[model samples]
Every structure is written in C-alpha cells, then in structure tokens.
Target chain A: MMSNTRTAIGVGAVALACILGSAQLVAAPKYEVVELAESGTIVGIVSFDGAAPAPQKITIPAGEDVCHSDPIVKEDVVVSADGKLRWAVVSLKKPAKGKAFPADDPEKPIVLDQVGCRFVPHVAVVPVGRTLRVLNSDGIQHNVHGKAKKNKPVNKSMPKQMKTLDLTFKRAERIPFVCDVHDWMKSWVIVSKHPYYAISAADGSFKLDQVPVGTHTVQLWHEKYGTLTQEVTVAAGKEARITFVVKPTEAAK
Target chain B: MTIQKHRIQLMAAIPAALLTITVLAVTVAAPGCATSTDSEPVADLSRAEALFVENCASCHGVSGDGRGPMASLLQVRPRNFSDEEFRYVSAPGGPPTQDDLVQTIRGGRTMGQMPAFPYLDHTDARLLADYVRKLRETGVAKMLVVEFADDDEIEPDEIAEIAEERVAPGDPVAIVGPSAEFRIDTERGRALYADNCSSCHGASGRGDGLDLPKDELGNPIEVRDITSGRFNGGAAPMEMFKRIRCGIPGTPMPEASALSNDEVWQLVHYVDLLAGN
Candidate 1:
C-alpha cells in the first residue's frame, strides 16, 4: 500500500510539471499576437466644402527662375469655405501605440525625376532620413532647387542625360521642387517621420492603415486650405469610415 | 492523502502564477509611460529679440522701422517698418510673405539698397524675418512712406533726359545725367518693358512682381531690384546685356532670343538707368 501511494504521488508530480511547461510555451506566443490587435486603421476623404477653383498660374521674378516653364498648381494649399484658417499642414503629430516602422535609409534614397521639364509626380511621400533621388530626363540642363527652410537648400545642376542625384531630408518638410530650365514645372514632396500619412488625391480620397484600435485623432491638411481634425473610435476587425470637410478662408481667396 | 493535497496545491498555484506573469507583461508593454515630446517650446522671445538686435537692427531699425541710421543713406530706404505696406510681394497680403522677406534678406534686392545677409545663414535669416514681421504687427515701428513706380512706364532715354535736366552739365554724375544729346524715347521703352518684362520683374524692376511662388524648400525667388546699383553676378552694362540675351542659369529671367542684338543693348541701356548708374 505504501509503495502504491508513493508511485501515485510521483506520477502526479510529473504530470503537473508537463502541464506547466506547455502553458508557458502557449502563453509566450499569444502575448505577442495580442499586442498587434491594438493597432487600427485610419481612413477618410479631404474635400473642398465649396467650389474648387480652376488651377492658377504664379510667376516668379526674372532673376530667380528655379522652375521656369510649367504652371505650378497650388494643390496642397486649400481654402475652407469659412475663409478664416489657411496654409495648414495636417499630420499625425504623435506616434501610434505599438512599434513604429523602421526609419528611412539615407544612403539609399527614393528618387524623384523631372522629364520634359515636368515634375514626375504632383505629390511625393517620403520618409525622413531617406535620400531623395532627383533625375533630369530632358536633354537640356536643369537645376534641381529645393526651398526647405529647415533642411539644407539643394541647388544643384542636373545636366542633360544625368541619370541621378541623391538628396536627404533631415527634418519633416513639405518641400517644393522646381526646374530652373522650365519655369512652370513645379511639384511638392512631403517628408514625414512616421509612416501613417496619406495625401488626398484630386478627387479627395485618403487612407491610413494598421492603426491600433481605439480612440484617435485624424488630421486633414490642405496647401491653401486650412486644417480640420476629427475624433474617431476604431473597433477591432472593422473598417472605419470618416469624412472631413474643410471650409475655405478669406486669406485663401 | 498527501499526494492528493500536493496535487490540489499545484493546480491552484499554476493559475495564480500565470495570471501574475501575464499581468506584468501587459503592464510593461502599455504605452502610458511614453511621453510625447512634440510640444517642446520654441525659442523664447527675449533670445529671439537679442538675435534680431544683433543681426537685423542694422538694416531693419532697432525698433523695426526702416529708419536705422543706415536707412537714410541707402538708395531705397530700408523698407519702412511703420508703413506696413510691403510692395515687393509674391503673395498679395497675409503676413509679409516669407518668400519676399527671405529673398530680400538672403539674395538681397538686386541693385536695391538691401544687401544679401548670407552671413546670417538661411536659418537665422528666416528667424530674423519672422521676428521682423512680429515687430510690424506689434506696431513697434511702421512704414512711413509707400512708393510705387512703373519701371516699364519710364524709358531709359526719358530717364537720361530727366537726369540731364536735373544735373547741370557735369554735376558729379547724378543718378540722372544732364547730357541733353543723349535724349531717347522714354515712353517707347517704358511700354516695351512693361509689356515684356514686368510680368516676372516687377513694374519698378524691384523683383516684387505679382503672385510670386515659393521654391520647393519654401524659399522665395525674388526679382532683382534693377533700380539699385547692386547686381548679383555683375553690374556692368555688358554683363546685363549678356544676361538679357543668354539669361541667368538658375533664375526665371529668360534669354530674349526673340529680340535682336541691338534691342538687347537698348534694354541694357534702359536697365543701366534703372540701376541709377
């Protein structure tokens, strides 16, 4: 009887140890997965409350022609209908709850090109610490001049057939790109530290993904138009839709 | 009996240990401990004011008036701080446009009384320009005079003739020479320049043409102020002639290939008078 009792006790102890070991293994993996669920998505449209005006042309002085030929469409700057606020930059002023995306690499920068005296894209989304490649596709020589107040000013020549020139933005800036060879050519590149940003298209659509589920603020920015902010609550596994209306201010007019 | 008791104890402790571990992990991973540093305070006004006094007071006046002791001596008085009317502008009005102010301070108004403050560094120049605008707002000083001239409206010949009339024979080479024999049609040149040049270069050739745009980096590319004698690369008549014909490499000023060589010379001669040469 004594031997049987001792045997039973030893078996119970072994069983308990195995169960605890399995629990530890299961708990460790689930912990990391749960952290990911906290992240959510942010999406919305940035539309003009009133009439969107036709594109206007702005001329620079004779001596300072960085981008000469193309008519610069002031798209980023938008005016609200109320006409009070103007020239606002809408961005995620804070980081999200979880791990942030990796910082951009400066040595290998994303390139922005100018072909036929036109900036390739009307808008550019760049990560901070990453290099921006500027290419001149035209036969004529062009100067790639950047007007960033905080970052270094880039006024280098892009000679004909020049394949590429690399530039890095150290700080966040909405930099304007001009080609002195062609006056009307103009474009904007937005440098951001965080990856959770999207510029509204001409039709006014934007999307921000992988946001942690919870209450958060979404910011809307217009070049001429002021900014509008909205509070949103994101639920787990559901797509959240929000709309932001920006009124034009008198200053924008 | 002993075996049964020990089994019960292990079962109870397992749940409790797991709970404690999970709770601790969640607590450590929570984001509340991370503080946001985005709202850090900018430079204090006193520091900015001292910087302004040290660098800008020489030209923009200690009180933000265009009336520093250097103001009276400058050909175009430093922009009067009291007037609040900024003529050389790209944006119509909203705050003195950063581009105009930056360009004025960095590149200096070409041939104008304002000299480029490149020594201030771009960042410092920007901060100083911002401080100046604040001064304008606080009414520390106001622009007392507002002057506007149509450069295209006045011809070199007319200006030369006016200079001739103003300066008797050889009166120390006044801005306007007194040589009656050098008479040319000021009206025709004014019309031509107004129609062709004023769009990019302001009506007064002050580089403050209408609706100027900011550069990619948000810096203003100002029109060269031809009325003042300071030219960026060179001020010689031949240099002006070459620029008019070939155009400057990085600027908006285009080469007037459409105009004849002689016409470029006429433009150059007219530009010289506009420079007060």
Candidate 2:
C-alpha cells in the first residue's frame, strides 16, 4: 500500500507540470511577420517659386520706452508668394501598418534642455508617454512654457539652477513653447503617438523609416506656410518619394 | 488526539498563507496596473505658479502687477499687468488675441524693451502666455485701457515697409537663440559668415572686421563686435535676429535680405556660442 501511494503521488506531480506548461504555451502572444513588398526610393526637391522679398524696417514708436536701439527690420523667412520653400516641416501622416516598434523605455526618457535661454532643438519628435526633461542652464531666470491643444500645457520658471521639468504629451500636436521673460525664444515640440515623423531640414528634405508595405498619407507643415497633405503607396522594403511645393502668400509676391 | 490537533493547525496555516499571497500579489501589481490620474485632466495650478514666479515675475512683477524690480530700470516698462492697453493688435480692437500675445512673445516687439524669449520652448511660451492672461484677469482684474493718438495709426503694409528699410546691406544673419545648434548647420553657417560677414564682423564675430569708409553721416561705423558681448541693443537671440533681419536704423549696417529665418537663427546661435566661448 505504501508503494502504491508513492507511485500515485509521482503521477500527480507530472500531470501538474504538463498542465502548467500547456497553460503558458496557450497564453503566449502571437504577432504577424510583415516584410517590405518592393524596394523603391522616394526623392523630391522642395523649391520656392517667387523672388525673395526685401526685409521689413521696424522702429520703436516714439513714445514706447522699450529698447532705445535704432530702427529694426523684420526678417522675411516665410515662403514668398512665388512658392519658395524654406523650413517646411515634412513627415508621414499615415504610418505603415505592421508589428509596432518596441515602445520607448520610460526610465530612459528623451531630454530637451533649455540652456542659455533657448530650446535645445527648434523641432523635436518624441513618442507618446515619453518624458521631456527641460533643463535650465542659464544664470538668469527663465520661464519654460508649452502650449498644446490636447496635452496639458506646462508653464514653469527655470531659475539659474539646473532644474528638470518632467512632462509627457499624450497625443500628437505641433506644440509651440516660449518663455515670457525672453519674448523671442521659440521651439516646436511634435509629440507623436507613433514614432514615424521627421522635420524637414533647412534645405527642405525629410525621410521616414521602417514603413510597412502599404499606402499612407504624408503631411508637410510650415510655421509661416500652410499645411500640405499627399497620399503615397509605399511597397515593402521600398521607398516612394514625393515632393511638395508651398506657394508664397499674395502679399509676399 | 495530538495528531488531530496538529492537522487542524496545518489547515488553518494554509488558508492564512493563501491570504498573504493574495495580498502581496495585489500590492505588487496594483500600482503598475492601475490607471494614472493624469488621464483625468486636472489643471495643475502649483506647477503653473511655479513657472510664473521663475520666468515672468522678473520683468512682469512678482504679483503680476508689472512692478518687478527690473520694470523700473527697463525702458519699455514691462506691460503693466493691471492695464490691458496693448499696442500690438491684429484685429482692430479685440482684447489682445492669444495669437497677438504669442507672436509678440515669439517674434518679439521690435525696437522695444521686450526681447525675444526664444529660449522658452514654444509650448512653454503658450502656457505662460495663457497664464499671463489668467493673471491679468484674476490678479489685475481689469485691462488697462490704452488710448492711441490719431497719428498713431499706421497700416500693416506701411509698417512692413519700414521693417524692410531696417535691413542692413551687409548685416550678419539673425540667429535664433542659445540652443539653436541643432537647427543649424554650423560648418556651413561659419563659412557663410566668413564669406559675407567676416569683413565687418571679424573672423571671430568681433566688431573689428575691417574699418570701412565713414558713412554719409560721418560716423565711424564699426562692425558690431558680437564676441565682445556688448550689445547696444538687447542681447536676446531674437534681438540679434531682428538686428540682422532689419538693419539697425540710423546705423551703417544694412539688412540681410538673402538669408532665410532658419539660416539667420543658426547665425544667431553661432554668435551666442562664440561670445560665450
């Protein structure tokens, strides 16, 4: 009888082990493997059509007690009426569908510092739920404020001390941030829900990576110029190029 | 009887162990699994106030009354927080629009005491601007009525023309701010500056580029010694941008009509870095 009891106990242990192993196997997540369909390159030049306009002369009205400096002219950086392109923001609007890229680690967050009264990057692309560390490296005091339609706006003073303002944007928005003390400071933070976005260079060039094989929409935005959208069909492992021309406003002509 | 008592104790301990395991699991998993309160969307006043005191109070006064210690020394008294009379407006007379405030903050009011706070990220500027409006409404409680003389009427187009005349002929490009390194190609920018600007601004951005003939007014116009860090105008990056974009009126400098804003901002960054170095 004692021998029989030992054999039964051994059998029960083996059955429990098999059940647990099966459970684990069944619970494992399944993901589809996607490959690039075709290899194509997308290349386009961004050009502005009109002649560069002359700078604008601005003077402090006689009564204003502001900077007593001489008359100042405004810079004309916006695209002219003749469709010139400079500093146009180009990015993929519709992301290719496939296995999502590994999410960013929250612990090792991206940083956008405000040292010496300026945003580190005029434009930044950050994933959702990622924390942005705004550091103050100036001896003088500065306020770091961000305005976003969907995300909560952050307005805080960055004293001479190196303080980090940790923030996260939950949605995608081309948010503009500035300091009240120093009026001219400005930067754009493009908080995206997905990771596929790029800012056009001063020469107006952009590239998007790891796009799954499919048709997607791309968007181009400029602070001064309006927004432009285009639909592109990207093959697997292939790059499809598209060009966008932004016309200057009538006054610029 | 002793065996029976021991068995009962063992059974009781099993239930207690299970309960302890459940509690431990809940404690460990709940914090990570629970939804965050940030999703609820609460206005964070403490954070906003902290930001205000750090950045705005220096010029706008600690109490949002436009009476900061710097206000007394500044030529254009920081906008009187209590007064709502704003001179810059896009619409004929709409309570200072958000865009107006933003544009003023971003581009900066030219030739005024207000310097561009480009260091403040765009979002930060918007938040602070909104908070300024809030403070104006709550702290000051009334917009200061600004009455303009009939002669003050200047058309936007006319203003644009005056702005154009401000550009200097051989002026260096405008740089955006201290942190504009990422936005600019410094190598290309340095070469451009050397080619177009080095003659007057000097190889090192010092004012001693080259002594040119006297202007029609007979003033010995020296290239702005940018590296010396002595700015007749404000030292803000935007201030430099404005100076580059629009030549300093009455100065020998001419506006840089060729460079784009991005290029100008890069130049501004280079100048700031060179001055600091």
Candidate 3:
C-alpha cells in the first residue's frame, strides 16, 4: 500500500521535473540478471563531426603549487585533432536482457584515483552490484560526491591518506562526480547491470560485449552536451558497429 | 537540472513554502542512497518544523543557529545554519548539498552534539531534512552571490566562464573551510603552532585563545577549536595551506607570507592534532 502510493507521487512528479531542465524524475529502473549463453557485442566510436571548440580554461582558485602545478583546463569535451571525442559515456538507455548473473569478467575492483586533485580516468564504467574503489592519492583532502538518479549516490570525504572508499551501485545510471574542495574537478561514473556498457576511449572508440541479441536503445551522454539516443539490433554472436556524433558546446547553439 | 541549478530555484521555494506542508504521498521514494537532481518534486512540508521545534530546537536553536539553550554547555557547539561553512555536507568539500543535509540529519553524529534521530519516521525525517536544507542553501547563496545585483545574478552558462577570469590558475587562493586529510606526528607542527597559531587558536588548538576576533558585523567571533571538528576553511592540507597563505578576508587571521610551503604543511599537521584526530 505504501509503495503503491509512492509510485503515484513519482509518476505525478515526472512531468513537472521534465520541464525543469529535462530532469529524469521517473524512478530509475532496477537491475535483474538471467543467464544467456548466446550473446552479441555492441562496439562503437564516439566522435564529433564538426569543428571542435577550444577547451574551457579552468581556474584552480587555490593550491597553485600543488593542485595545478601546470595550467589545468576543464575537459568538458576533449576532442582530438582527428575528431575523436574523449570521455563520452555510451550506454543502453534501458537494458532488457543480456548476459547472466555474476559476469565472468575478472572481479578486479574498478579504481578511481584523485591524483593532482583530479579524478584519474575522467570517465569509467562499472557493473551494478560491484564496488568501485575510490582512492585519494594526492595526499590532500578531497571529497567524492556522486549525483546519481537511478543508483544510490555517495558523498564521502577522502582523507589525504591512502584511504579507499568502497561504494556499490544497486541499479543502472549515468552518474557525475565532483570534488567540492576543487570546484574545477569533475568525472562521470556509468553503471550497467550487464556487460553492455562502455566509456569511449581517448580516441573515442568503445565496445560492449556479452549482450543478449536484440534491438536495444543506445544512448550517448556527455556532461557538456545533453544526450542523444538511438536504436540498434545486435545479431547472435555478431558485433553491431555504431557511431555516435555529439555536438560540441560552442556548436550546439 | 544539475544539483547546482536547483540551489537557485530552491531559494525561492523554501522560505515562502515553509508553512506550505507539501507532503509527497510517497513513503521514501528513494531506496538506498539514491539521490536526485534539483527541481525536486514539490511535496507537503509537515512535521518537519514541528519535529524540529520539539526535538531539535534544544541544540539547533529555533532558527537553526547553533545557539540552542544547551549550546553553551556542550563542548562542541551546535551547527550555525546561517554560517557559510558546514563540515559534514554531502557535497564534496563545499557546503552540504540538500541530500547531504538529509543524510546527516537522519543519521546524527555520535561524537558531537548531533544525536541521531531514528525516531522520526522516514517521511517525517525527510520533511525535516528538506527544511534544514532550505536554511543552509539560503545562507550559502547570500554569501557566494552578494556582489551581483538581484537582476545581475550569476547564470548557469556564465559560471564556468566567470571562474576562468575571477579564479585564475596559479594565483594564491583565499581559504574557506576545512576537510579530511593526511597526517603525521605534529612535533614540528606543534612547535610551529606554539610559535605562531596558539596565541590566537589556543594552546590545545581549540579556538579558545585570548584576544578573540570579530566578523564585519561586530559580532565576537570565537577562535576556531581544531578539535571542534568544524572548519571555515576545510580540513585538508591544501585547504589549510590556502587559509595559512591567503588567510580569511576581513578577520584577525592574517596570511603567513613569511612561512614557506613546507612550513605551512607542518602547521596543518599540528592543527589536526589539536582536533584530536
């Protein structure tokens, strides 16, 4: 009775929230695992077709001798000369069915480091139910806060010591993290229930394997650019190749 | 919208909507640590103020200032909602974001004056959390955007661009508050604190030293006790360095221009000791 009423409120709030910045008020979906021996792969490259705008110059505010030993620029969009976009999140909007429970992938912990007061691996992907090891190596205090919609959010302070904050995500979502201490610092942590999610490389290429063969909604998200979605079909044991082109901030207008 | 954008909108809704009691019929929409962006769905605000006045007012005060009647008796004072700094905020190093306030309010701390209020039902607790967040957000907004005219307020698109110019890289920064950090023995730091800081910060690093300072409003500002565990300039070494090097504006805490990079680092160690870390 209680949860039923709550769902009603969530549903009612969704329309109002969408108007205010297209916020995702709809309760993010939960993850379920079922075994599937026959799986396919989704591989793609994220690139910008038009001219890449100059990087945003980020001010360190303080800690010049340490935080920004060198001039640091915000990586809102890291587009190389070859048109490859770095740090783009490529994920399935709503993953229906894919691989089974407890993927065979090595259970190595995903590492997120605060080196130079910045999140190393500016963009990363982790499977749901897995813990991400958040390390503070800069020997300076840094805080880790995630703005998550579907999964649980974390707001923890990492002491300068080699402390590891183990945070686990229970659902799938595209989460963005920031360091309140260093306002310029930002990163994205994308979570997926199955092995059908990947972050684009510095060269803008990404590959998602072990996906159940079917048509699925693929989405690309960038902190600077809003979001774009597409539908593609993955054949049995075949690699479905896709290309996503995002609008750079300057060109978007 | 992102969380930051919600801060602007929240300012308009919270104060006026204080008595509105916009309750969302939901029990606790969020399951685990799930959080949402701003543009929060409007809900009935109830027992929040009532619960606060009844249970929390003794320590948090009627207006949320750390000036409850029991405030003076306690070793660590209650939080001052109007103050700009809040150490336990959910946001990283900055002040507590709305969700942070909710979590902290729900799970009150063990060591300090904040006693966990498990008695408040999730719905009642959330109502109270929203009210507490409104107070903190109002205070932060006033402090951060005082210079801009009401009509000329900073917009979403302009923040990143403005930061580039106002907060240039490589420039010495003004310190704001404390955060968690690394530490070693404070023997040398203890000496440095004795020589430089103790006169104002107290021998034990509590802000109880002689010759206390005052803010611009002529209110007597107590010297910060490192042990109190709340900081105006975060607790991290760099945050401490930012404070030590640049110092707080319009206060008796002057910058340590003479101290070298290594010397300031040592001072941070000592201060942590005073905090009983």
Candidate 4:
C-alpha cells in the first residue's frame, strides 16, 4: 500500500512540473541580448527594374474639407524619379542574439502622424516594446486601424478633439494601418525586434549597421512586391554592399 | 457461530466502504486541483471539430473558411475564420477572446442573420470556439510560410511557433455599465449623434452617409440602418455600451473613444429611442 501511494505521488509531481514548464515556455522571450566584440555593416540600394506604373489616383469624398484640399495618390508602390525603390524594409531574416535595442522614452515615443487624411512617412519602423504615438494632426475623425499579425491590432477613433493615442507591440511584424473613413488612406508600420533593420530612403539607399560578422541572409519586403532575400558576407569592422532589384507584381500591373 | 459470522461480515464491509469513500474523494478533488494551474486545459480538438461540423458547418464552412453552401444567400457574409477577421470583438482589434467567441455562439447576432445555438451546452460552445481558433492558427501559419518562402532561415517549424505566439488573443476590454443613477437623456443623445454619427450613419440613421464605406478587405460594406431596430452586437443597453466603447473590428465603424462614459450611455439611449425601442 505504501509503494502504491509513493508511485501516485511521483506521477502527480511529474504532471505538475510539466504544466509549470509549459507555462514558462509560453512567456519566454524569443530574442536574446548579447554583447558583441566586433560587428560589420550592410549597406544597399533597392531599385525598381520595370517601367514605373502611373500613380493611382484617389477620389476625395465630396464633403470632407480636410481631405479634399490635398491631392491623395495611391502609395502602394512608390518609386523615385531615378528608379530608386521607396518604402522597402530591409533586415536580417533571423537574428537570435544581437545588440540591445536603444532605450525608448515615453516622452519621445515614435510618432505615426495622421496628416491630411494620410499616414505620414508612408512606411514607419517602430521597435518592438516601444510606444508608438498615433497622432491625429488632420483634426478630423480618423480611426487608426492596424491589421497586426504578431501584435494585438489597434482600432480607435481620433476625432478632431482627441489628438493622440499611444500603443505598443511585443512582437516583430509588419502591420498595415488604414483609415476606414477615408478608405484610400493606407500605411505600414514595421515593428522591428532587432536593431539590424532599415527602410529604404527616397534615394533607395538603406544601411544596416552593427550586424554580426558572418554571411547572413538579408530580407527585403515591399508593400506590393512581397518578400525577397539575398545573402551577403560581412567581416569585422567592414561594410558589405548589396543591391535588390524589385519588379512590379502581377497584381500591381 | 451466528455472532462470529456477523462480526466478520461487518469487518470486511467497513474496509470496502472506506476504500470507496477515499476513491470518490480523490476523484472529485483532482479536477479542482488541476484548475489552479496557470496553463489552460488541453483542448480536445476532435471533439471540438465534431461539434463545429454538427452545428456551425452549414454557414461557417466545414473547413471554417466561411464558404459554406448557404454563404451566398446571407446578407452579412459569415465570418471567414481562416482570414482571422472577426467583427464584434470586445477589444478594438481582436483575435477575440474565447469568451467572445462563446458569447457570439450563444447569443448570435441580434439581426438574426446567424441563428443562435442556445440549445448547445456551455461546454459544446467552448469546444466550437477552440475549433475556430485552431482553424485561424493553422491559416496564419500557412500564410507565414508563404510570405517567407524564399528565406531558407525560416523553417516550417519556426513559422508554426511564431504563428502560435502571434495568434494568442489579447485581453478583453473592460466594460463598466451605467450606474443605477443613470437616466436616458435622448435630447442630449440626439445632439451627440448629429455631431458624431451623422456623417457616416446619415442625419436620420438611414445609413446613407457620405461615400460608400469599405472594410479592410476592400469589400464595400453596407452601413447598418439603425431604424430597422436590429443591431449586429445586441439590443441590450449594456451590449450597446460595449459596442460603443470598442468599435466593431474589420469594419468602418469607429469607436466613440472621445466620448465620456455618461455621454456614451446618452448616445445609446438616443439610438434606442430612434429605433423605437
């Protein structure tokens, strides 16, 4: 009888341990912070290969005074005059360990401003765990609706009276933000988990500094063309240059 | 000899009854102890699937993709679970809480487009909700795999791991109902509605507002005609309060975030008055 009791106690203990272990795993952090002795940089330019499509025109609603004043155009695919691709996010595909993200201050949080019924910057990069202040500079009733994959989606109305709303995401993913009132207003916010990421400038130039010294796979994602990857090798204290040529997708045409 | 036999019988019976009592105590207490753990109980997927097939498959699709045979006939398209799009979530945007799904299943939409399954026991409703969640998790995992197809670094296992973490629902938004002292002020509500809702819902709640409103999927959405006396969320004042506090997800309806709690109640009363409730 004593032996049977002991066996039951042992089984119950094991089951309890398993339950506790799984709960811990659910809350475990995906990325780890490590001190690096040496690191390199990856600089690249993203260019459009095909003939630029004509800018898509957006029809302004008749009575919205704030939206009617500005000429709104589709920003799904924006290219520079000299074939430089704009708004492509470039980053390392998988970085398990890296430098710590810069400390984020609540007072100076990353701003995703809504101006003239359009999200400014068209594409914004906000660090994971950092606060993103959604500003309604347009002074109109605009809702910031975020279709987030890895984070809790945000939907809140910012009327003319309400100026700002603050939010934060715990995971890294590209979230699409749109205004339902003005359906044409669209934007993307890339919540980056690591510092090894950059958005292409108007000149199509992008740089990822302090990437670990190794041959790492680089990823580029555009709103229209989807995700593309290429590999580049980096040496200690050196810079590796790579170029990504993007073409319009069938849907874009 | 008879006395000796009776004593022996009592001795055996006492031990047997004691054993039975011990077993019954352990059986009853085991489940109560398990609920104290932090981890949720493991969902019975097969049971959930069977329940979903029996009850929800007619409209929600056998695969939970919102493409059942009766889908085309419905005015409001049945929610596409695979797309991870839900309309009435307590939170602003949602991978809705399990409770949220259960509420919808039990209550259905007030408009009666989707019939209520009040006959199903609470346990069965929960199983169906879990099944819907499984469908969404699988769909999201597949989408990730496709989005990162070219990258050799992101394995299928890793994508699945990410999807599991990403699809965990956020906490339900807390709703505090109107206080006992509250009164329906339709006069104040009418003024508030004109300023806040008239642009989208029309001056008389006819839903012939500005331009056509479209959902996130770019599908043109017909605004709710409030005069019809049917609401997507529910007719209860408390339910209307929740809808006003947290906007309907996936649609163009914006939350009245700028309004005070009292003001929202006033607006709700005004809407009810408009619908002749």
Task: Give lDDT per model, in order.
Answer: 0.49, 0.49, 0.57, 0.70
Each prediction's DockQ against the real complex: 0.03, 0.01, 0.02, 0.13
lDDT of 1 by residue, B218-272 (tens): 3455667777667763676654654554443224444344454555556667777
Global fold similarity of model 3 (TM-score): 0.51
lDDT of 2 by residue, B1-277 (tens): 0001101222232222221111011111122222111111114444545566677677876445677768888876576543333334322212344555666676665545777777877666666665565543321111100110011111111221221121101222324444544466788678656644554566788766444523213444455677777665456776667655554322334344445577667777777777774
Per-model TM-score on C-alpha atoms: 0.44, 0.37, 0.51, 0.76
The lDDT, on a scale of 0 to 1, for candidate 3 is 0.57
* Clashes in predicted model 2: 80
lDDT, residue B138, model 1: 25
Error of 4 at A123 (Å): 0.8
RMSD of each: 25.5, 26.4, 14.3, 15.5
For model 1, the local distance difference test gives 0.49
Deviating ranges (above 4 Å) for candidate 1: A1-37, A52-91, A96-99, A102-109, A249-253, B1-60, B63-73, B76-277
Regions of model 4 farther than 4 Å from truth: A1-32, A236-238, A249-253, B1-51, B68-76, B95-103, B121-172, B179-191, B216-218
Model 2 chain B lDDT-worst window of ten: B142-151
Pairing residues by index, what is the TM-score of model 2?
A: 0.37
lDDT of 4 by residue, B1-277 (tens): 0001101222232222222111111112233233121223227645665677677867877656687778988987887776646677776456578888889998888664788889988998988776676666545544453454333233333544565565566567677766787887777899888767776788899888857787767788778788887887887887787777777776777767788888888988998987778
Ranking by TM-score: 4, 3, 1, 2
Across A20-52, the per-residue lDDT of candidate 1 in tens digits comes to 233333221110112464556666665555665
Stretches of model 2 off by over 4 angstroms after superposition: A1-44, A53-86, A96-109, A250-253, B1-277
